[model samples]
Each structure stands twice: as C-alpha cells, then as structure tokens.
Target: MPVTTDLVQQVLRLANEVNAFAKQCGRADLSQTLVEVAARWKETETTIVVAGAQKRGKSRLINALVGRPGLLPVDADVATNCHLTLRRGPVLSATVHRNDGDVEIDPEQIADYASTTGDPAKRRDVLGVDVTMDHPLLDGVRLLDTPGVDSLTLGHRQATVAILQRADALLFALSAQDQPVLRHELEFLAEAMERVQAVAFVLTKVEDSANAQALLEENRRRLATFVADAGRSSPGTAAALAPLLEAPWLPVSAKLAEAAAAQRSLGREDRAAKLQERSGMGPLEDYIRACAGGRELTRSATVVSACVSVLSSLTAVAEDDVASASEDGAEAARRLAEVDKALEELTRTMRDRRRHAVGNQFLGREVSAIVRARLARVRQPYEQAISELGTRAALERYLAQLPESVEQSIRAAWDDIVAEVSRLVGRALNEFLAALGLEPMEMDLAKLSMPTVWSHELQSEPGESAKLDLLREGVPAATMAVTIGMALAHLNPIGFLIGPAIAAAVMSRRREWEQVHRNQAALRRLVSEQFTQAAGEITLALEREVASWRVAVEETADIALAGQRKELEARRAELRAPAGRSAADRGQARRRAADRLARAGELTERALALRGEIGPAVNALA
Candidate 1:
C-alpha cells in the first residue's frame, strides 16, 4: 500500500517547522539536525528522569526496585561511572552502557565495567559505572541515571554538560542538607527544565532528617523566592524550569537498604508502636506511591507508536509524489502515443491526397500549345519533314500499334504505379515548351498522315511512253529490307551485312510513308524526355516534403520529453525528510542509559533519552 498525501504532508510540515525554527535559532550542521532527530524521538518516546544527589539513597531506591544490589554502582562517595540501562525483555540479560555503543562485560565485574576500554583523560574509556539492574519499572521501559550534577570531580562538569543535551526528563534529587537553590544546581535545573517537560524532585534521606515536613515546606518557599529572584520565576539559572518546579517533590529515605533491613530486623515490641510501624517505610512509601503515575515505559511506548506512525507514512512511498511522476510519465507516454497515432493517420491521409492529386489529363491541352508554338520556330526544311510525315501510312500503322500495346501493358500494371508514363510524357512536353516560350499544337495534330498503300495511274494514251517498265535500277518492293541492305553495302564496304542493313533502317522508310516516319520519330524522343523530367521533378519534391515533416515531429517529441524529468525530482525530496533521523540522538540515548549505574540521585536524570533509544528498537523486535 502507498503512503497517503495527508500523511506525507503532515510529516513534511512537522519537519519543516522544526528545521525552520532551528534556522531561526541560528544553528548549523549537526546541532540543527539534532533537534529534528530529537523531535522524532519525542514523537516516539517519553522523557522521564529519576534523580537524586549522592548519598541520598538513590542507589538504594534502584536496588529495591530491581531486587538486587551491585546492579548499580554503590561506592562510598562521589560515585562516578558509566550509566547502565535496563531494558524490557522476557529473559534477563544486559548490554553494556555506552553512549556510542555497547560492549559485553562480566556480571561479577559489573562494578568495574566502563562505557569504553581506554583511559578517561583521552575520553576513550567508560568511567566503569556498573548500571545494569532488573526492576519492574525497567520492564518494557528504558532507564538511565546521571552523575550528581554539582559534583566537584574532574569529569563532573563535562559529564553534566554532555548529559544536558539529552535531558528529556529530570529526576532532580537532593537532601535537606543540600539546598536545591544553589547556583550550580540551579544552573543544572535550568538546563534540565529547558530540555525536558517532565521534572520531578526527590528529597532523599528523609528518615535521617528530624523535620521532614518543615524542610519540605522550607525548600518550596526557597524555590519560590529563588524563582522570583531569577528575573522571571526561579532566579539565577533555573528560571526556565519554574513551571515544572511546582513541587514534584517527594520525600524518601534512600539512606541505604541496609537501614531498611536493619529497621525490619528490630524487636516485635518496638514494631508494635503505630509510629514505629510507619518508621522505615511511611513517608517514603507515600512519596513512591504518589510519584508512580502508572508506567513510564507505557507512556514512552505510546509516543514511540506515534513516531512510528508518522515516520512510516511520511518517510517512504509518498503516493502523491509517485502519482505525480506516474501521471507525468503517463501523460508523456500518451502524447507520444498520440503523435504516433497522428503520424499513422497523416501517412494514410497523405496516400489519399497523393492519389487524388492532379493527373496528366491536362497533357493534351499543354502539348497542343507547345507543338503549335514550336512548329513556327523550326526551319522550312523541318516543315517539309513534318508536312511530308503527315502523308505516310507506314508511320501511321506503327503509331496506332504503339498506343495499343503501351496502353494494354500499362493497364495490366496499373496498380503498381501512381500515373501512366505515356500520359506523363505529354505533360512534360508542354512544361518544357512553355519554359522556352513556345505555343503548343492542338490535339488534332497528333494524327500524322502516312501512306499505307501504293497506287499508280496508267498513262493516258496507248501509244505514248512505250514500254515504261516500273522496275529500273532498284526493286522498290515494300519488302524494303533488301533495298536498305544494298544501300548500306554501297555506303560501308566492310561491316557485316545485317549491321549496316539494321543501321540504315534508323533513317529508312517506305516511299509511301518516309515523310511520316522521319518527323514522328523525333517527336517520340521529345515525349520520352519530357516523361523522365516530370517524373524526376515530382519524386524530388515529394521526398523533400516528407523529410521536413519527419524532422518537425522529432523536434516536438524531444521538447515534450524534457519537461517530464523535472517534476519527478521534486516529489522525492518531500518523502525522505521526516523518516531519516540523525545518529547523534541514538548515541545520546545509549550514553544516558549507560551512565545510570554510578548516579547518586533518587531518580535518574536522562530516563527519557533511554526511552527514546530503546522503545523503538524493542517495539520493532516485538
């Protein structure tokens, strides 16, 4: 199934708005890209934090939840190590905490594990923060803890700054002894609230404190004052977080599970006191119950589902873009097909046009004018040739037979040609004559006179011209072959008898038809020349016209093809923007997850980042 335009457009708009805002912020390169990626993460996951300062029973809280200790780092003071992430799985297992990547570690040496294998100065090795833990909240969820933010340690400032970029949720933790109103802590708070939406505060070691209620109210009042002093809300650096600062505070005693176990082991009589029954667990349990607003993992999952919806629909197979391309291609195809169809139709019509074009019936009119005009130009000698040929029956017999034979053969082959050659012959003569400014003869002039029979009148008187025998030096029989041969022998002495005899026939004619044969033969040659010229002229003109049409069609087709290419490219850009996330967000999620082990907080700082990272990867597996 194809992705819909509504889906594509919505995702595109979301990304565009984010990027545009990023531009307004004057960010470049990886930073702007980071926001877009984070937004994608937000769409897919929820950022939740569980935070507290060192010695605030933060690790103890984690230990209780996971039903295991040493799963997270439990050092004496200022604990600093990689954050371990707990993921939801059917079988219990762990991947080493890493911002960049995960590495295997021995569970026995979990305390000694690091995000990396090398030195801390070079920033090559993990800080050896063992963070893997099995907990109910960790099930179907990703969890993380950060190093106490205001630590005086060497990497503390760097780690704090590094972790801030990924603060999707803030589990701000503090003891009554340590004010949440400190400048450095306030700065971290500013960073936290600026980044994450859900901020919760945990007051740890409440069991050790005498005035827990009074301390809570005092902290709240101070926070309000601090917010007002910070120019807008909480003064100094936490002003951005004033909104979430509405006392998500929960008082809990993370004074170590050893203390809780010790309290449980107390005498039954001491446990009988109502105050004693609530001693180890009362206020802390209340805080835990209140803060436990269902499951963080589930919330994160819902967001992830949303992200997947947007991305799957927005990132690939945009139907509108693909449809547009298909439409363009189809349109172009249709046009080319139309052109092909048109060309086919044009070819058929051209045939009909050619067949119905002018014919040689005009030949009679044209040639008549030509012969008449050109006749006067010929010398008196040629006039005799024309005049004498008119009286020859031998030529007339040949001319009549020529028309019959030519017409019969042409008719048999009529379909093989466009027009008759004999007909075209007459038309060519007129055109030639006209170019030379000659008038043509009338059609009647085609009837050349030729004598086919011979007769002699007997002399008038019986006594006159005695014994005038017709045969003199030659026998002039119409069997004129022998006479022509004898004449050719006298003209050429050594050639073959047949050759000279045949050659003499070129100018030979019977006495009765010599006039007709002589001139008419010349006219036949002229007519044949005219036919060749007209046929050549018409053929050349038609060939040039067809060539021009083919070139025009080709040029038009090329233009149409070019426009289709551009529309295809624009559609592809719209699809890839929302689905493709940057690698940095992924790295941050892993890092925040890994660092949870050595964190000294009631709640982890970047749990949301962990959720963003693991939720999709896990859901995809499912």
Candidate 2:
C-alpha cells in the first residue's frame, strides 16, 4: 500500500490504540515510548529562514513571496531589528512576543515593531514577531525573517546565527548591486550550511544592477573557492554543497514583484501577471515550496520507521508471553537463570567492545593526525597577517579583530572534525550491533554545545617582557560527559551520535616597546606560541568528543539489551502466575495470551506494509 498523508494518519491512529492497550495491560515503558512519538508527530511545522547582509532586501523578498506588498517594511538605510515568523491562519493578525509579554497588533503594523526605525523604546524590548495571514502557502510552512548578517549590533548578528541552528532550510539573499560579496558573508554562509541542510541563493535587486549575470558568476566562483579553502569533507557538508552549487541562482526583483501586486489590486490583472513572471518570484516560491514538501516527507518517513521499531518490540513481548503461558515452573526458572547469564555476558562484551573501539578506532593515530593538519591550517593566516602588516598601528588593528577571526576559524575546524567523527562512530556502531545479532539502525548525531573563546584578553603591558599566561578549562563535564546509564535512559533524538566545541584562553604579557623599535619577528614568535597552546586544547577537546561518542554507542547497545531483558522478565512472571490455578483458569490465561499475540501480529503487519511504502515515497520527494 502506497503511503500518503491519509495512510500516515491511519498509522498514527494505530499507534494511539496500541498505546492505550499497553497502558491498560500495564506496559508503562511502551506507553511512554508512544507518547514521545505522538509529541514528535505534532511538531511538524517547517521553518525556512531568510538571511543575508543588512539592506540586502530580505524583507522585500519575503513580502513578494507572500503576495503582500509592503507587508514587511523595506528601506535602503534601515534593516529588520528583530526576527519575524509568517504563518497561516483564518484571519490576518500579528503578535509581538517581547521579553516581558506578548502584544497583539494589526498585520499592517508589523514594520512598526520589527524594523530598525520603529518605536525605539518598543523595539528595544521586542524579541520576535509572529504574523498570521490567509495565504495558502503558509499552511504548514513558516517564513522567518532575521536580522542581517552585517548588523552593526553584535547581538543582532549573534541572534541570526543562533536561529540558524534550528532552522530547517535557508534562503540566502545576495544582491547583484553589491557585486563582490564580503569575506564575512561567505563565512556566515559556510557555517549556515553546517546547520541547515537545504539552501538556495537568491540574487536580489537584479533590476537595479547593470550586469547581474556577471555579479552572480563572480559570487559562484568565490563561494566555490571558499569551500575548497575551508577543507570541509564531511558527509553532511557534501550533501549541503550539492544543492548550493547546482541550484539555479534566482535572479529576482522584489521591487517589481511588489509593483505587480499593487497593479493587480487596482484591477490591472494581465499587466500584473506579466510583471510577476518577469520578476521571477513564481519560481522562487516554487523552490521554497519544494523544500517544505521534502521536509514533510522526511518527517513522515521518520514516524513510520519509529512505529515499525515499536511494533517489533510489541511482537516480542506478545510472543514471550505465549511461551511463558505454556512453560512449566521448572522450565520457567531455568529460562530465567539463562536470561540472567546472558545479561551479564552482554554487559561485559559491550564494555570490552566500547573500550577497544574508543582506544583503537575512534581517536586513533589517523584522526589525531587529521586534527593536527587542521590546526596548521588555522595558524597559516595569522602567520601571514603578522608578516604582511608593516605599521605597528596596522598590527594593533588586526590584533584587535584577531579574537573574532580565530573564533570563527576554530569553530569551522571543529565542525569538520565533528562530521568525520560522526562517520567513524556510525560504522563502529553498525559492526557492534551486528556482533550482538541486532538489526542495523540509522542514528543522528547530537549537536554539541559551542564554548566561547576568551582571546580578547591579549594585551601588552609595560616592562612585562615576553611572558605568556594561558588558562584553559575543559568543557564542563555535566554537559559533555554523562553516565552511560543516564544516556541510555533518555533514548531520544540526541542520544546516538556525538559533537563538540574546544575553548582556549590566551593572556599575553608583552613589554610596550617604543614605536621606533617595533619587532615583527618577535610578534610572529608570540603568535606561534599562542597557537601551540591552543593546539593542545584542541587535541584535548577532540578526545572528549570521541569519548562522548563511545558513551553514546554503549548507551544505545545497553538500551537494546535492556529491552530484551524486560521482555524475558515479563514472560517469566506470566508463566509463574498460573502456579496453583485450576485447569479452567490456566486455559483462560492461555487464550488471553493468544489473543494479545494476534493483535501484536496485526499491528506489526500494518506498520511493516507502511514502512515499505515510506522509503520510496521519501526518495521520490527528495
């Protein structure tokens, strides 16, 4: 049977019924698992973020997509001050969610609250805005308008980057009028790729630029070179890179699109339609719709796969119950002893395998060498910066900005390292599961917490000479390392793969020599020393990240083993319950076990049938 939204709903109902039955039968574990599944199923809203430099027409592009001109205010000098989410509703309305409270407002007043030139006092307290419209496109998708990547306020830029961590897709806008994109913009795009998988580039203001094609081509070349220079080779990076480089650069004129909408409102239908086509907003809207559709398909597939796993578990429980109903007391006791022995051996083997893999496979010589190579890449630019800057003032300016630059580079490097670690751990997990005679399960890596680097403390003191005091702390153990049992207990989305951030603090004590005797060579030496210390911290962080992966794999295996033990124990109790019952009572118990077994089989069959349909449907959508 082909799986459609209707079939997905049917399976959902089946899951609910199964959950209620489990609760009635006193299977709290299974009930809890289904409850989590239902929660995930309801969290289906797809988010697409529009991001770019300030005054790049991000707000204009959004207005064009929603077929509402002047919906979000646009100005050459002003930018969006806060985030805004546009969703669908029965009537048009807007709400400003502030730090203190939410304030409902008319849809036309969005700019008054979200734009830079809005009420200054109100804007200062604004966190984000939510707008609901009667547009068809917003049925299951939300368009998030964010502050520009080049916002002067550090908090605004940080806010944009933070939201990317949770967005499903990115619509990166590049203006043709701003021909050569800045280095910082490209860096932001690269980081965005690590977080959001589906990305599309829109060349805005094409009607205003003289040579739009040339501008687009130049950006393409620059982005390709940037990716090559970053040395990113992770599977996730590869997947993200394909659409980024291959998708047609959408050359759109939001101004023209808005004009078309205005003309149509005045009853100039044909002229408005032609202008809309020329503006290219139709194709851009299509691309956004495709991204949203693909995400929905993936979500459906994930739900179906989870259902299959739970159904398999239910089948095991029912079969075990039947076996218990037929077994004698002595046989049941013997089986319980056997299960205890198997549990002990399983734990021992899991520990041995986890230890061996972490030591020999996860962070062995090969990965260590890779980490060192990446650190060298990070050091190369600082070395060049020192040798190239001639004046002491220029050096000071570069040093002032060095902390932010170094933080970006180190974060990018860690992202690449995390990708590679995820790959190796996935393979190790597959082999480990196979050795235990378990089915192969695909796992998602958990997003690691990014620790900030305190490199701004770099300074020169009078008569201090060249002493360097460095303070480095490992990532907090509570966040990075938890007990394996704790990890096993929470078998949620982030329990399988591992990720991380390495923090380094540098404090330099240097004598403020006279401008006449400024020594470039000595500065280079100090830079090298700082890098050497940071590399040590990086290496330690790598070890911790891999250690987290080892714990994850162990937790997953333990969860599987625990499920088996629970089934066995349930079966033993069932068999022992009929110890001194009458023949009629024993017969009734067997019949009950047989009926539960039949129900489990039926649910398992339906889930498996839907699973077969899901893979092909999701692949087709992709």
TM-score of each: 0.38, 0.42
Q: Each prediction's Cα lDDT score? A: 0.41, 0.65
Candidate achieving the largest TM-score: 2
* For model 2, the run of ten residues with the poorest summed lDDT: 501-510
Error of 1 at 289 (Å): 9.6
Worst 10 residues of 1 by lDDT: 453-462
Give candidate 2's total backbone clashes: 0
Candidate 1 residues 385-422, lDDT tens each? 43444654544454445434433432332222222322
RMSD to the native, candidate 2? 23.0
What is the C-alpha lDDT profile of model 2 across 539-615, one tens digit per residue? 56666655655565556566767777676566557656676777677667767877887887787677556545544
In TM-score terms, candidate 1 sits at 0.38
* Model 1 segments more than 4 A misplaced: 1-16, 24-26, 29-47, 76-81, 90-94, 97-102, 114-124, 127-134, 177-181, 232-239, 255-622
